[model samples]
Target: MFRNIKTYREGALIEDEQIKSYVESFESELLRGISTLSALSIIQRHPDEGIYGYQLLKELEQETGRTLIIEEGTLYPILRKLERDELVVSERKDSGGRPRKYYKLTTKGTELYQHMVGFFSKLLEAITPLMDIEIKLPEKKFIYCPNCTNKIPQEAEVRFCNICGLNIEGLSK
Candidate 1:
């Protein structure tokens, strides 16, 4: 009975299981590419104080409105890889009784995160026109970096140009 209403293949009716499988596969493949960036961004936000593994997962869920759910077991391997690459540094801290490892971004990681942000911005701008719905930028005028002319939104809380590494706090005003 359920299967009768659940299938679609091209224009014709098909099994719902096939559609579910296809969606799961597609989503997994896409998330695999962006997971590193997502993790990096979370770590970057808490630069001064490092965050532990479980807390990082919780933050990711909270920040993304729970849409980007990653399993607890999968998060460690990603953190280990980031540490091995020297993008992030980790140290063990004794909390209560158990030792929890906290991770923070290194200088290299911060620079890489900035680069990734710029890349993602440009990518979204390029693809906005192709999307079905119209997209709009904020009405406030954008500020360009005096050093490198990189355009930044007026509301951005950046102190330096991600592209040129120039201190822009004074210049933005």
Candidate 2:
């Protein structure tokens, strides 16, 4: 199957003729199987209320600067899988008299999401020097767990990484 060139905006993914296909394929491959994480991220944002499909799509695009786009056709299946796996729970709500299904992360999901964010952040930070891009992490607000690299709020006064159960009390010293 061939991806239509017209679908991609000029100079966006198709920046240079020599590396355009490689670049396009690289991002597509890199982003494969990331929908779960993306959906979790969006749902985590609406912590108290949760979010709907359309809103998740919009926020995914906006938050990623449109670099990652998940079509509705694909999103529902991923959401269903997440639900089946117990990562998210769905609730039906009446908003303005219209019923809609909203998704919220389960406790297990929340823990997993935190670990994923930490892992991804560490991945980026590790590759920054090679990419020649500096990513300034907010150490004052959060610290990466030395054991599993899970992100922990600096102010939380936790003795362990919530995700990995790694002893972190001494890190405060």
Candidate 3:
């Protein structure tokens, strides 16, 4: 049916069945308030300075409006794992009256962060257009005749409209 051929909504080109399935199969795959990639990005942005377990929990809560509930128990274990992997380092620091262990990214962590930045950047660039966040601009073209309805190649400066005999007007516009 022509009705089922194509539809546009919210700047997205999606099939009706695809949208129906998405609604029917909605899943909350995002755990820990954000994805692992987002978690690494947060640490990378705040590198150099060490973050205490509780501080990290609070920061995550504040940034995500408590959507990510990072308890110290869950966070400390992750930090320890990172430390063991040599991606991060931790030290007990005394601040006035109390001593707290603080963690910061090590050199290896910095390198990993750089690699992740590039990887995610490329991934986002590729996926953003599909997600409707960005759209690729159409190339300019001049139609040689008005009746032509065929698509012109990217490198072609002029095209002939198959439908009408008149030159397509304002195609490049």
Q: Tell me, by TM-score, which candidate is best.
A: 2
Residue 32 error, candidate 3, Å: 6.4
Candidate 1: worst-modelled 10 consecutive residues by lDDT: 1-10
Question: Which ranges in model 1 have alpha carbons more than 4 Å from their true place?
Answer: 1-15, 134-173
Candidate 2 lDDT for residue 152: 82
Question: Taking the tens digit of each residue's C-alpha lDDT, what string does model 3 give over 97-163?
Answer: 8998877788777655544444444455568968889733233432222133233333544443333
Q: Cα lDDT of model 3 overall? A: 0.56
Local accuracy of candidate 1 as per-residue lDDT tens digits, 99-162: 9998999998886665665565455665887886554433245555555545566678888787
List the candidates' TM-scores in order: 0.70, 0.81, 0.50
Model 3: lDDT of residue 41: 55
lDDT of each: 0.74, 0.81, 0.56
Candidate 2 regions with alpha-carbon error over 4 angstroms: 1-25
Question: Which residue runs does candidate 3 get wrong by more than 4 Å?
Answer: 1-29, 32-35, 45-48, 65-72, 135-173
- For model 2 the local lDDT of residue 106 reads 93
In candidate 2, position 113 carries an lDDT of: 82
The predictions' CA RMSDs to the true structure, in order, are: 6.1, 3.9, 17.7
Error of 1 at 90 (Å): 0.6
Model 2: per-residue Cα lDDT at residue 77: 88
